[model samples]
Target: MSVDREPGLRERKKERTRRAISDVAMRLFADRGFDNVTVAEVAEAAEVSLSTVFNYFPTKEDIFFDRQEDVEQEWGEVVRGRKPGESAVAALRRHYFEALERREPRSGIAEGLVTFHRMIEESPALRAREREIGERGVEALARTLAEEAGADPDDITPRVVANQVAGVYGALYNEGRRRLLAGQSVEEAYPFLLRAARRAFDLLENGVGDYCIRPG
Candidate 1:
């Protein structure tokens, strides 16, 4: 039992150290913009050596957006873990609404999002990194869809569908973030967000054929 517990204990210690460094770094970044905060300052504030910080985070941006890897893979995991008879879009839509219902940070309905969004918006490096991260998420979802459909290597349908699904989801998330930044309380924005999410997903599910045709 002692031997079995040793590895688990070590892993927990490592995770705790990583979380501490991340928490300290985010505080500094929130207080002073991402670009203004140095990795050395983060290490000093976290009471860890610069080398230790680097051991966990390869770059300063890495420290600021520590959960990025999880974000990149999250969509793929959600689709992969969907229940029997559930389509990928249905699974993702369900997961997203559930997140919003909980007022979770990832759903962009939590407190402190204004500061976080402003920090990212103010930093060019962070904005570029965010775009890269979004692209990776789309790619990850596309790959999963392709695998699930058993598509031919030359088929582009999976990529096309992935972009549309991700696009709708991204638009809804951005709208929520924008509303939060514009000073709306989470409770005030909840109903509108829920309506917007339903309408967006409904468009995707039911298709948007000739909704805005010009009269001849």
Candidate 2:
């Protein structure tokens, strides 16, 4: 009989410490402001040393964007595990709607208070960091698409598809943020995002099909 090796106590403890530090940092940023919160204060509140906090998160911005890695992983999974008959655009559209149904915050349709949404929009650093994350996500998605299509990494088709898919998410995220800042509840924002996603993907599916069949 083979015994499955679970994570050791030390590893679990380290993960707990990491979460504690990140949670404290987010709470502080939400209460005061992202720009004003200091790493030392977060370390003290989380009962970890400053070095430990840095060990978990290399920089202050990392704590605020802890879930960025998760988003990239999900995007890769969608492309790599798409159904046999599904196009890349179809796979991404399905993933987005599934996230919406689950009320995932990364979908940008989850219930968050208006203040938090406004605070993110008002911070230039956060906005810039978010754009960087967006680019990373697009690149990851493109790599997965290239694998699925048996194309080179630098091929234009994968890049174009990734741009379209990422553009849909970007538009949805901004619309959700705009509506939340305008005092719309998550319930009110959900349908609008869903409709927008459908329209965006429809345009891509039609446009791509036409382009692929066009004569040289």
Each candidate's root-mean-square deviation in Å? Answer: 6.0, 3.9
CA lDDT of every candidate: 0.85, 0.78
> Each model's TM-score, in the order given?
0.92, 0.89
- Candidate 1, 20-57: lDDT as tens digits: 99999999999889999898999999999999999999
Model 1 CA lDDT for position 99: 90
- In candidate 2, list every pair of residues with a backbone clash: none
Worst 10-residue lDDT window, candidate 1:
207-216
Q: What is the lDDT of residue 186 in candidate 2?
A: 90
Clashes of each: 0, 0
Candidate of highest TM-score: 1
Q: Write one digit per residue (lDDT tens) for candidate 2, span 148-204.
A: 667765679877878887888888878888888887889988888888878887887
* Global Cα lDDT for candidate 2: 0.78
Candidate 2 residue runs with Cα over 4 Å from true position:
1-7, 113-116, 209-216
